[model samples]
Target: MKPVRRRIRRHFGLTAKQVAVRSKRPWYFQWGITVLYVVFGYGIAYWQFAGAEDVHQKLRQTALENQTLHTKIIQVERQLQIEQAAQTNLAQQLNKVQDENMHIKQDLVFYKNITNAKRLAK
Candidate 1:
């Protein structure tokens, strides 16, 4: 039986030929695997970061929209209160006018009675 000697380049560590001889994978394939893993890691990070930014932007926009809607509601409420106050003032004025008309009618009736009595005396 012959004793097999370890090759001198094998002592320096694995050469491309040695790795191919042992694992049957080409050097380019190994580099491609490394690049693929790097690209996949970067892709995951990019999507996660981008999604977080999108959510944050939506939240900001929603807050602004909510503020705008709330201001509009406050404005509408104030307008309704002002309109209600005006209606109340107008109703009070109408009651005052009706009372004044009643007084005038009573005075006219009293004058008619006085004239009828004077004509009878004549």
Candidate 2:
């Protein structure tokens, strides 16, 4: 009784030491919650980094494919231009050959008339 009086007097009329009145979680439970938070943070970070790398890889692949297609288009255009020039040259040659053929025919007819006239005179 004297000890209780001394404690009450020392604490200003209350108990000298504090005691928990409510239930608390165990130490292991608190540690488990902390570990779960850390693991969750690491998982989210890994996902972010991996997703960025995947996007970069896809972009590089697309760029490479586009470059290949562009090169093919340029080659085809050059071939088409070359074919068109060749066709034009052939058309010019054909026109020159037709003119020469007509001239030759006229000469043949003139020679025939001269020979017939000479025979008539004889």
Candidate 3:
């Protein structure tokens, strides 16, 4: 029984309770390290926010450029529509002139035939 108890105690690490000892450091040194960590963290946060502001500014500039391009596209489409309409009107006018020229040629040919017949009969 005694051997069994000794083995259990050794295996379980319950032979004795050990206390840990630590050397105390000065409070000022701890406070100084804490302040330095806080200042460093704050500086990093400020830098990140400054970079974000630049990114936001660039995003706004790009948006403005996109809007300008969209406006120009609309203007160009309107001009194209106007030019197409003018071309259609010009084509219609040319067709009308061709038809008028064909009729005038037919009349001239008829007049020439009549004059030639009269001369041959005389």
Off by over 4 Å in 2: 1-52
What TM-score, computed on C-alpha atoms, does each candidate reach? Answer: 0.55, 0.54, 0.60
Candidate 2 global CA lDDT score:
0.94
Query: Model 1: runs farther than 4 Å from truth?
Result: 1-48
lDDT of each: 0.89, 0.94, 0.95
Rank candidates, TM-score, best first.
3, 1, 2
lDDT of predicted model 1:
0.89
Cα lDDT tens digits for candidate 3, 5-119: 8887776666755767998889999999999999999999999998998999999999999999999999999999999999999999999999999999999999999999999
Q: lDDT (0-100) at residue 62 of candidate 1?
A: 100
Least accurate 10 contiguous residues by lDDT in model 1: 1-10
